[model samples]
Target: MRSSYLQTDLLSEFDRLQQQVASLFGGFPSSIRSDRYGSFPKLNVGTTDDAIEIVAFVPGVKSDQIDVSIDKGLLTISGERQALFANEESDDARRYAQERYAGSFRRTIELPANANPEQVTARCSNGCLMVTVAKHEASKPRAITVQ
Candidate 1:
């Protein structure tokens, strides 16, 4: 009975450690069902002297299917990815694994305080969404000449 109790405790501890590791790696896990958003696209954020840049990786999504919007200092990207095996030819195939993300997904990113929502621009090219938000004039750095 004591050995069984020790085994149960070890399993619980292992599960806790696994969850912590998953959270550290941007919520990615070994199990398919662990994703809270159902395998949405990943993004990269950066900033230039004048603008903030965001690139979202959406391989199967089209330009027209995506919706980009900014409201109250939040940038939202939403779209739907149709299933690849929708056609009749795939109906008879036995599916062993499906790791791709299908269906609708929405991701919201918070804009910086200096970001100018009015000067935002977004374009989709080569399965990536590039969004640029210009910084406010008052927020940009200015040089003062020494007299």
Candidate 2:
């Protein structure tokens, strides 16, 4: 009877430990399902009739500073952000200055199997980086007439 009580206590302790761990990691995000606060350059993905559209909100990043590439059905976007020092006094020092972000950032996105790498297009404008991946010819929807 004593050994059985010890086993029950051990089981209860393990259950409590598991609950504590779960509560600690419950708020942690899994992949892109995040709320975008912890993610840099939040992404918007959508599918059109002809292509898969992706937009990365990259404010204060220049077109030249951005790099986009695709290989093995994985699209990668990487770049470095230069630090900005704004507002200065007579001697060249700021009294109150805040820097939101700086340095290198890299993000990878998995493309669909039907996405044609050759038809990929990327453009940066108005603080947004837009990427379009065209679908394969055979994967596109088409109308068929019944015989």
Candidate of highest TM-score: 1
Q: Candidate 1 lDDT, tens digit per residue, 1-147?
A: 999999999999999998898789766655745455554878999998899999999998999999999999999999898888664236676767556778888889999999999998999999899999999998888899999
Candidate 1 whole-model C-alpha lDDT, 0 to 1: 0.87
Best by lDDT: 1
The per-prediction CA RMSD against the true structure, in angstroms, equals 5.4, 7.5
Candidate 2 ranges with C-alpha deviation above 4 Å = 1-38, 86-99
* C-alpha lDDT values of all predictions: 0.87, 0.82
Model 2's alpha-carbon lDDT is: 0.82
Score candidate 1 by TM-score against the native: 0.73
Task: Write out the backbone clash pairs for model 1.
Answer: none
Kindly list the per-residue Cα lDDT of model 2 for residues 78-138, writing each as its tens digit: 8977666543223465435333556678889999998999998999999999999999999
